[model samples]
Target: MPVAAFAVVAGVIGAGPVIAAVQGDPALPERTAGQLLADAAQASRSGLKPMSGTVMQTASFGLPGLPEVQGGMGGASPTALLVGSHELKVWYGGESKLRLALPGRMSETDLIVNGDQVWLWESEANKATRVKVDAGAHEKAGGHPKPEEALPTAVTPQQLAQQVLQAAEADTVVSVTNTERVADRAAYQLVLAPKDASSLVKEVKLALDGETFVPLRIQVYAKSSAEPAFEVGFTSVTFSPPAAENFTFTPPAGAKVEEKSLGTLVGEHGADRGEGADPTHGRFEDGELKGKIRTVGDGWTTVAVLPVSERDLRTPDTGGQRGQDAGAIADTILKSAKPISGAWGSGKVIQTKLVSALLTDDGRLLVGAVTPEKLAEAAGRK
Candidate 1:
């Protein structure tokens, strides 16, 4: 997980946007915080009816002095979300199998819930577990179980209104800007700022549909920061009932069963699937190979090749130790291995197991290797 975090950081830093679109007028008129919140809450409740649609989710992390890190895990490559009473479903590929929150536990693996019982399946672990949920358990897990931790962060139209109203009650002003188009529907822009600076959320902005009152966009800003730390934009949505099987869960035959907390599973899986830093670039020199490199996984070494405009990195003839002299091939491999920053410290270091040079689909040269401690550091009982 730590290695993945580092790689994500590198990716985010490498990608940055210079311009941002203005959705609502900042000088829009103000309304009583209560009225705005009430309207928002009402809209949320009414829109909660059985519905199904696609939803896309992405998470980005930013730190001081470093570039931002962004990653997305969703069933819809770019979008997926479903709404319904009998069955609700959402999927984010590569991030998690499926998620279900029942009373007292949250499962990010595959899950199926029927009235009083919930079934969970973990394909990677080849295990299926069942649990009975009651009213008490629901309350303990926060009224209702959600698939992912990010779900709670999303505010429905009604929830947005209620939150705006609550902020108003606290003497915070709620301002509703002019209606604007989002996903082809007119939406009311609402902004709420706290009267005190010590509040958990400094400010929240929401875009609610004019007719359905569904939330189209949400932005959250930190107390002392000017930029939004988190943002969710709905590209598409629907209000149709989901399929009956959407909520059904059945374990495959011969699967193992066990009792465990959701937190335990998340911690365990996160470490196992975590990524590492980006590889450094280098080349062969003299009888040795030298270049920038980073350690990943357990005993895995990764080398990044600098983009060369004149050279094609993907030719098969470029690889294979058989063609090159032993000394030249060894030197080429060693020369390409350079130290990577922030991948190691006094207590941790990356080790290489094997090295393979290949070309990416886009014709870029890539070297894949294993790190020794990478897996050990990321895998353990939560």
Candidate 2:
């Protein structure tokens, strides 16, 4: 879903009282949740305007069972900013991608769809893949089922405000505190606790610009836990209209292209695994796990996966280019693979990385560094 706009923070119990004091009016029109949300949504719709600016985001999360293994998987700790109508630049995945002209290079995770087909560019490997937008598989894969339909012109501040409002509508509250500044504009801060204590998200604090009513920051806390599930922040914003050509793309000559029915790389990757293995059952150590490994373009393939027992999870071996520092990389991956409890209980994909994939016996596809220790821990070895 549109890459959850921002990560939220938890354990903000004292924040409400502190924010109320900063607002300078303890009794200032205690707005009901509904009234406040409506006003925010209205403000957002009215504030729609063409603009452009930069944004810098930093997000960090800990692992599922091993909190000690922190900071393992995200690209760069803090994302650099240089986005606008004509260009969008990002430093991630140990590389950089810049979109300055039509048919230019793009990051592997970058998605560009124009006309009837969607184009995915992997600048690191210098390859591009294409999938028809009207593919029926996209309907099942959570993408725009029909590209021919009229698409929203842009993601406006108003649309963001509406999302926040929808969340607020479910839980009624008596008071909200407005503080903090985003994009050099005033923002409203709200502290909310889930009505149901068992919810995955314990508490959420949102910062919405007072004038524009757009979301500036969001922090999500795991219930009964002081640690945050994830956190995201926004800055350097411009509302200028993007150029028509910004969304279009044309494959380069001699570029290797593959057709897929799914909308996202994750789905495509999963489908590949399913097709290569027996649907009834599969083993982690068997040769069924083997698959073709190639760089997006001309780079050499440098990732692999091997089976490991529970003891292997605790044992660290010195080999290959260590992903960042061991502790940091472990933390990043764990946090992204937070656990889920239910019938379908499979963990969620917090973030996708450009690396190798591991198909486990239990139907889990672990992606990223395929180190013995990393895979062991991810596969619940210990």
Candidate 3:
């Protein structure tokens, strides 16, 4: 997970507009913070009823400027994904049928899951990949996995809200702030603020639909900042089941089609590991991760420590353009990182408004939403 994500266990106009459409706190039936949290949590954990909507995501972590890449299907570029306003069309037909489409300039990318079949289509490349969902894995995941779990894509407000609520423990002060309008629907706003002063996160806000208790929007504010640094929300939505056709995809004629299995799609098969697998990448043993990765501290101040080595920096295809792009991005991150030394040892530290990361000289990477000092302290731990 990204350090920013670890910070909260961790958008827009239209849906990205947040409460921009609201004149003031909307008049709604009173509900205590506890009631709101319980309702939202229940809604999230329960089977998702059929729904479709447009989701918008915006990020302003104050990251250093990154190199720009050409647009099109390539617009899915890693750098472009990190900073900008992006929109996605989502369709949830049931537990076994879902679709997400990311439309770009003259190009569109889509992931469609219908029952046991999954299709990934890239319009610009005129290619499609068909994969069979692992029956056991699909059942274990409760039908279909989330988009983030299956592929790299912007998260919906529902997903982010559940994550924030899970992190709202005794270390957080939870309260019902006021009612707001999101997607033109009156919603109860629940705010969660960290009790830890060292945490860079100021608070997380979730807007739950007044009628259904589903989250319509979620915003994360950084310490000392009034505006949200990251947010994702729905601009428009409907509870009616999406058309069945939306879940089906027939690869365009002449489009290249590749076959794969669920494990192959994620490179999780043991055969893909070859001689050895990187512990930092998460080597599983008997179904649980052991020894390689560990967490320090608790709650909002928690930090994750991962063992690293030169091997982690080497690309599988060092001579390819993909490798060059990866190298450039790494260089940019390193350039922005500051040199630091302490009892934890000397290396580089990257601090953003909401998260901090440390790459130590002795092969360790510690990341969290805490201060650089906190990360260093965790690194010093035996």
Candidate 4:
């Protein structure tokens, strides 16, 4: 997990139009802060009923000095939010079926999950990858896996809200503020702020549907900032269950297809299934990571040390000698990184407004929201 993700994530619209207004509605019982927390926690643990709707996500990372990063997706460059107000059509049929669509300029991409199978289809490329789901996965009784676990796409509020519930209670200030309208539905605002002053996060707020108690919107802010740097929420929604046919999919003819088992899709049988429950420290489950991930600090400014792997970074054609080229890829990334030295030793440092990273002489990637000095200190720690 990215350090800020230890805070929150999302997408959005033109900043000017989202000042949510609360219209007169039924008198829903006012919930205390404790009750609200309990309710969110319950929602996280319970099974979601069938529902379908459109969710619009928008993000703006307030990276200072990088004028190239200003434009959200759809623009030429990249922003912290990943892309512009990404609209997704979402569907859920209890626990047995699920589907989502991401509309694009030329073609829409989709994913469908039914029974013990999941399929990801890219219409533009006319390709699909199908994988069998684990029979034991459903029995675990937990919130759905992260979006990356579901598919290589955006995660729904139903899934992300559960993550907040589990992580917030331990180090955050939970409270209830005023109500707002989300997707035209009345909503109760639940705000969570990190108690640690060293945290770059200002706060995270979730908008719970007044009627169903489901989260409709989530926003993340940086410390001392007025606008949300990242946000995702429903622009419109309906609680009605979707038609059964909506959860099914048949790849278009001529499309390429690949099959994989659940373990291959999720790395249950990967190179190293280390003994830890923390997702943030994991780098090589799918094999893109060729390193040992270990945290160098605790709490807000935790620095992560990832040992670089020459094999993972090399091109497929590079073959055998790639292992000997250890820092080759790290060096490529260090082109923009500046040289720096500390008591720990000399290395390269990359600093953005929100994220700071250090590449040590020994091929270790130390990164965190803290400054380079902090990362250097962490790299030197005994």
Candidate 5:
């Protein structure tokens, strides 16, 4: 297995255009649901080179407790960057060569990943962090593979499609509902609807390219909502490989430099993947969520529970210290979390469109792509 190279380029997942049910052209070969998924997985992994596109994302969790996010979200991580619009020019030249140009007030923040050398040049801060990409990709055959470097737990449409197809088949009703276009490329809309009514997610729709079978776009809709609560896709794309210069960058003179390995740079997030069916575990180095991690169930309806310790909650990792006041940050998030109690006991709940988590006062976190009831049930269990 190779290290996934996809990063959170421009985090703004929004409701995409309505994919209408239409007849597929009779001229085109028909594919069964199983066949389409198998082919898509294979195609997404092959011949990915020299591609450039506009990455647009609009996100709205509709959670009241989220600070700085009143209506919607756009950027990545932390609540502060949520609720806005951001567009980034992304270039992908295989897994070793990748680039993202984010415009800023003074200059621009560019992330360049060329081979083992990865550089993040932030013009505003005049800082550059150069690091070696992680070595998670030692193939059994020999040497390293060209697969992308994994970022802080963020997922791409193609990656999500593969994960869902592999792990969520039994838990969801999979179907091809509509034929649509993304970034001017014709695509098939594969819809995955959860069979479990206790899950909050209404459905996950993936638009796979007609020819390549690569997932061009993925949209997740909350239960009862026609529009997607989170979506990401290429607004405009070119299959031709980007120029070599795109993946190379040089920081300005006098810029402060802080270098760390990709693992160190991502803190604990590099290993924490919290998708519904995907199993993941890690200590909360970021002080957001930490504890003895474990999954409660399997498949799309699966839930995860982590027992938070008093020490982990109190400690925050600031650059200098173990971190800023970890305790303070946890306290802030806990304060905002809505309070609730039931047979499963009492806890504060952070409800978002894509995921929901239950934080008990007793220091337990139960999270998943499930409803409150599902989390509560998991919580009540010994």
Candidate 6:
């Protein structure tokens, strides 16, 4: 699908009022579960019209609180999204022109993707990084012209909705719960409940815009809680295309600018090389653990096993203060992980409301939405 442009923005710590579920419910025409699913799938494949909106994400993982990092980088850092409530402003003018602004108390971070050029500017640090995407290379990877393939992984509501829908066909019961009004637009609530009791996720709810069939909100509920452990949605939205100027970016005069390219980011491998390739033969590069990444089982019970060597766990001398900060955070998380052992050997297991992870002494890390026992079963496999 052409969803590569949907994840440029991420969550940030902030506060906002709860958007009402509408006074009662919008009087929208009834849509059968199958029809809604088919329409949503088609909408995702076709992509959405140019639009702009404010997004809100809240996470309550039921795990120990993560220590907040200091400085301008902290606001946009991945850790910030794990807990608390946050918001981001997004402008999408087709796949080639997009913008994401994450606001903080004293500074702001913006990511602008215009044409083949992408800019990441941080106000707090007065730094900017410009990435040049080769259109030919991007096209080889996927028909979608997205430069985010060169960046770290991130999940958006629309992207998550599609993934959940794919997994739902095999292991979930899909139904239309009711009508909802999201982002001031009428929507249909489609709920997918897991058929496997061993899975930690109770259900996933998606609110699809009645007119466009675009996913406006996504909520994931855990088996132990009635409330969603993770929820993301638009607070306000307009389907009209944003101004062209919104995608243009110019770094501050005094900001340090670093230039990069898609080839430099992904190494010698062509962007198209990884499709259906054996991840076990993948190579590690640029701080990413590539090799030894593989999945077990199928559907909602799938377990992804990643390798983490002793060197990978140690604090690196590079990246200066940021590296130290990241190492400290990893240490804290490891300290909080529960020690576990079995016929599968010894390791630490981190259990959240909807996910479970086992970091083995043998350097293998098994993670999935299934129970810890399920992880152990996968571990015991050859």
Q: Candidate 6: give its CA RMSD in angstroms.
A: 8.6
Query: How displaced is residue 40 in candidate 6, in Å?
Result: 2.0
| Deviation in Å, model 5, residue 281 alpha carbon | 11
Candidate 5 global CA lDDT score? 0.59
Q: What C-alpha lDDT values do all the predictions have? A: 0.38, 0.39, 0.67, 0.58, 0.59, 0.67
lDDT of 5 by residue, 82-186 (tens): 444456788888868989887644567678899978998766567788976657634433664343222112255445434434443344565564458789887
TM-score for candidate 1 = 0.39
User: In candidate 1, which residue ranges exceed 4 Å CA deviation?
Assistant: 1-35, 44-47, 54-61, 64-108, 134-174, 181-185, 193-203, 222-227, 258-382
Q: After superposition, how far is residue 173 of candidate 5 from its true place, in Å?
A: 1.0
Query: Whose TM-score is higher: candidate 1's or candidate 5's?
Result: 5
Q: Which stretches of candidate 2 lie over 4 Å from their true place?
A: 1-22, 25-32, 40-108, 135-175, 193-203, 221-229, 252-254, 263-266, 270-382
Tens-digit lDDT track for model 6 on 1-382? 1132122211100001111132234467776554554565556556678999999989998876665554433245456667879888999999789899988778887889998779878787787888887768756777753433422332553443344333333456665645588999888886656677788988777778888877788888999999999988899999899998999988878899988785674452222222112222223544366554789987668899887643455444335444555566667767778887899898888789999988888988798998988998898885
Alpha-carbon TM-score of each model against the true structure: 0.39, 0.43, 0.75, 0.64, 0.69, 0.73
User: For model 2, where is the 10-residue window of minimal lDDT?
Assistant: 75-84
TM-score of candidate 5 on Cα atoms, chains taken together: 0.69
Which of the predicted structures, 1 or 6, would earn the higher TM-score when compared with the native?
6
Residue 141 of model 4 has an lDDT of 56
How do these models rank on lDDT, best leading? 6, 3, 5, 4, 2, 1
Q: Please, what are the lDDT tens digits per residue for candidate 3 over residues 1-382? A: 1112212222111111121122235478776654554454455545467889998988888788876533334246546766778889999888789899998878888989998789988787898989876668867767754423321122554445444444344566665645688988878776667777888988887777887777788888999678888888889989889998999899989999998886776662232222121233223433333667899987778899876543354332233444445455556666888888987679889988888989888878788988999998888896
Candidates ranked, most accurate by TM-score first: 3, 6, 5, 4, 2, 1
Off by over 4 Å in 4: 1-28, 62-83, 114-120, 127-172, 195-197, 250-292, 309-333
**Poorest 10 consecutive residues of model 4 by lDDT?**
10-19
Q: What CA RMSD would you report for each candidate?
A: 17.5, 14.0, 7.9, 9.5, 8.1, 8.6
Q: Write the per-residue lDDT of candidate 2 for residues 165-282, one digit (tens) a residue.
A: 4434333222466546666766666656644322344556676656555566665565435754454545555444555555667767777677665446556443332221212123
